[model samples]
Target: MSSNRRIGIIDIGSNSIRLVIYEINSLQAYRVIGEFKQSARLSQRINSDNTLSREDIQSIVAILKQFQRICTANQVEEIRAAATAAIRNAANSQQIISELQEYSGIRVELLSGEDEARIGFLGMIHSLDIPDGILIDIGGGSTEVSLFRQRKLVRSVSFPFGAVNTTRRFSADGDFSEEKLLSIRQMVREAIGGERWITEHPGLPMIGLGGTIRSLCKINQKKHKYSLPLTHNYPMSAEDMAELMSWLPSLPAEKRKKVDGLSKDRFDIIVPGLTILDTLFKESGCSHYVISGAGLRDGLFQEAYLTDNSAIGMSMPERSARNMLALHSCSPMAHLEQVASSALTLFDALQQTHGYDARARQCLHIAALLYRIGVSMTYYQFSKHSFYMIAHSRLDGLTHRETVLCAAIASYKAKSRVQQLYAQFKDVLLETDIDVIVKLGSLLQLAIAMDSSETQVLPVRSAAVTLDKELDITVQTQNDPSIEYKEIAALNKDFKKIWGLKLTLLDASSFSTN
Candidate 1:
């Protein structure tokens, strides 16, 4: 019944609904703790006019209450529920927010189109390592385009031509024609400052987001496989997507559902969605995309966490926070600070012997900080916690495969947890990475042992590594004789086992700052 540091976000988008719980890993990656999605289609009603019907309001209330129950049951400390186009443009948004907050404890913030676009990319830029590009997110009521140069978000524009809106304007009654399609393109061009706007940002990559792109990914995933349809990190080359674009406009509405790879759920509006994608691709002159299931919901949760006091909990142990986030929408920040410090200390002590370059050391640092995150469940049974949190956190700055290695090393917090963790990742996680995780775990264990006092654990501030036969560590100290040799005996033994060399420790009485 211990508490966690989970933060929950309820995203009321145009096409679907979602609630996500996430936490930071030892690698500073925010993984998804838990998530639930509902396809409410709130956008369908509000697109034609700036108003919400009684049914649309009621549908929103019911979903908000359900999400509230989830937040309460999980003991979520933070909740940031935001509405996009539908609610923002609604004639009666004030009344809606008042009703939701009163009944469900879910306060609603109506986001302007530009702010909506910026919030959606929070997870995309920080966790996934997206390069400079135009981030185009097509929603139910509007499309948001943000421009970035060398990774900084520079200029952003939003258009009223979202999926549901465009369908109403151009694909009424599920029919497609060259003229209707041209109008859709014309609307998009005007909203984004004409066709020449594309030439301004020459070669920046186009990082597509939102439901329209993900649905397209599902279709391409099926078409690429040919036999069985499966969804999970199915990367689509721009060339592959361009080939499929040619055929969609010509296909009739009812016949669209009959086509292979089209999901029954999206048959009606996929053409409009694809039209938006096609125009953007042609104009951007960029190919290659990183498809993600994470969008506004993830970004909203991240922004809420930073704004809330929950960020204070980020310094707790990974095990404690992982356990908390497991039960709630929370995790401890202790692991981030502790493991980060320990890894830096160990890296400084053994850089030469460990053969670590700057990037390799940084990787180890991330893995170390995120290691104990898996142990957050049952403290004694922490390896599983490491595996799930690291792999599934949906953190920014990491690929799905890169996350497996982060989880792998975290499993080593408990001996033999590696094999169990590796069972799922051997095909994806590299052998060298597995070795590094084990090495990092062992080194971390040594560092923790050295700081037996825990109080005023000065940490190995500076050290030199020598390899004659055994690894020799010459460490300097800044404090008086409060530290004891007995406190560090076990650390040397663990050092020997992991390195296959004896550990020799020399402590200097006093040191001068160079």
Candidate 2:
């Protein structure tokens, strides 16, 4: 809520702990300022006993202390710490949590597997460009696969056997025996099978996450002289993966170092990561890994919204917006910005009178951001194109129904297209909420007319929306009543018919600014 400052998320994974500082900006954009990470491997010893050891506790304390200092120095308002895989698996995690709270003054929250996958998918999706693909987030202790069906996540599952876990069972400093490789492959195939990962969906493309895949992407990019591998959009084929896995361990550490894009931190686990991904592709018929720079960190930021609103949380709108943007075929950054500007102008003018809370405001914001996403396809009947795209978009933080509503709101601009274009979503929305969409759509229509130029804002003054007997919206402006009045009159006529209300206007003289 403060300017240039908001909160930080400290994500504790089995292998590492990280602190991220995010700023919620005026355009409703969240930006990262500081990111700090450390390798702790808290889940290292929890395999046999499913419990945290004394060493693990000490390590967590160290990470939390380090993170706290970074958060304090950065003036982070909220420090929400989330522990996954490691703490979730550990028997003594509570003891560790209490100790940290008492001695280190840090609070740690352990999340459910499903929630973790959802959030992790959020971060991963936000960090890259994969309009429609299953997100494969292979971590230290477990692998989370989330399906973005028709551009929306229909299912997600967390499987055991992560990079660190696999390294222990499959990887070796020297050449791993053929027998050892086979055994590891069998184990990975079995672990993945336990969740029926392959059986669920065939021919899915993957957007790979975690340090392992990132390191893999980095190495390949450098081999190709790709300075920025994450943004390069290199498609890693099954054959490419198999070749790399074979070559990874045979090379000594020095030889491995020679390979560009590979991080020193990821040396030990790279082989197993590739093996796991290779197996995933072999069985699931997955094509390639769309390299990702974002994963768990993005998930943690979305958690702030999730923790704040459950069932209907901060995620509902935020996720819906991001999903809409993802589904949009247009240049994601530019188009979403335009929609956000247009929607906010209308929302700000009516937020108070409508008692629009954060959730409603968030929905409006997302709808505005994704309004023209359909333009990415054919501009002809773009509104209809935009609707289906946003509805099925794989945006993090939003649920299915919210996504539909967002898509619907985006399509409200084209009248001949008929607002019935969103009849599909009517089944999912509340009657009251349907009315809200109507109001928002009405406002959008009015705003779009003012900005035929669509150049962000207009010089129109003091817009008032009142429902006295019938809904009455009056725009008091110091402009020629001729152009403004004529345009507004036409807008109000349609607004009254659709919303079942009579609309009115009162304007000041052009010479006298109101």
Candidate 3:
């Protein structure tokens, strides 16, 4: 098998049909290369007899044909297509599948409610490292709620009604009066009330998937003028949801369309979607709401193509750092590994003086691995470029604040530069974080200087703090070690300023002689 493969996944959702192309490397790390989405609102086309209209099925086939061509053009090695509630709940699902296959030459996998819920759970667990939480996926035709403890799926249930269908039933005219809103909430409460497990686990964070939840996250971020724009693990609260629900209905239809971060296509259906989320939030007694960028499509890809499942449930920051290193770094893996090792050695040696925790240590390690990532773009002022990339890229499993800290550490050049960068994101950071960033960044700089040659010649044999309050790092090297020594000498002033300790480097022979 080739070391690299490109796979295409088509998700036939009730509200939309999407094709996402992912390029997978040898290590099983994958990134989305291309995506296309067309809104078909298949649920709205369902007949009174619980069958999708033939016209909609034909439209589905046409979209599949186009997706197939795009996949072929992208040299996609394989395509995995799955149909969720819209087609699965149809009375003539078999006939619809046959026509779609016969026309588009694409085999469609009809996911049962259980399958959809489980797959979505898989996506959530792998993407976020939440140990215990309730997972809610609001789709166009159905909503899947799952509870997991210790990173394993405990129970899952799929509700029959979702955003599109619910809207068609209650607010088809797009005017939500007090009575209509009450009816919508009551129906959602009754549907969720049947599941006793939902209320059993109270105060657990609710991890949300699907388009509706993402829209809510985006709008909140925009409303608050949030510093970080990425949405994978964005967090809100029950109060936040209630605030949006209360505020949105007051806006006239025309005004709602003008709200920033809300897509023009979602104007009519957003209210029903928010209603579903609001009901779930209140029913589950969740304290926090976290948005997941991955959903059924990511779940499908992981189940079908990912060769290494070990990354699942691993330390999220570490996993995210390694993935970024594999996908973006221009340096050799050995060099990056050596830098990380040296930085950690220094961190552990000076832990007593710094009094930092494992979180800061993890940030330092990630920064060491990714500090050179910006070299992929341009070597000129690469540190600034590295800072921008790390700050903005989807470093999954990291809170927005932690992500900024990592970026600050990776691109550390001077205290003034870091303070300037921190100014832009002070809303998300603490005043004390500047002290942490500078200290960790100084350690990273010293580590980089130790590997200035990128030949892995100066591996730290031991690092310690002497009685005189000076940091002494001993290295084992076969070469002359002069290059590393000269580089370390240049950083001594900045290192002392940040660490409050004079710096010293001793070769193995010199240490043994002493």
- Residue 350 in model 1: lDDT: 75
- What TM-score, over all chains together, does every model reach? 0.68, 0.59, 0.97
RMSD to native, candidate 3: 1.8
**Model 1 lDDT per residue over 1-514, tens place:** 3333667878887777788876543333344668888877666776355777766777778888888788778777778788888677677778766776776667788899878988877756644455577778888877877777766778777776777767876766777788888887776666556535554775666777787777777767666543212232335677877776777767788888876767665677887887887787667776566665556776776665544343453322333233334343223444345546766776776766677566455555556566555544566666576666667654344444455655565555544666665565565555566567678667766554454444433445445555465544444554542453464564566566777667666555455321
Task: Compute the lDDT of residue 506 as modeled in candidate 3.
Answer: 74
Candidate 3's C-alpha runs over 4 A off are 1-3, 309-314, 510-514
Report, for every candidate in turn, its global Cα lDDT versus the true structure: 0.65, 0.65, 0.87
Q: List clash counts for every candidate, in order.
A: 32, 10, 0
**Candidate 2: tens digits of C-alpha lDDT, residues 3-91:** 55467888888678888887654334455678888987664567476777777688678778888888888778888888878677667
Per-residue lDDT of candidate 3, residues 367-440 (tens digit): 89899989988999998889889998878777788889999999988889778877989878898998999899
Q: Highest TM-score: give the candidate number.
A: 3
Pairs that collide in candidate 3 are: none
Which candidate, 1 or 2, has the higher lDDT?
2
lDDT of 3 at 64: 99
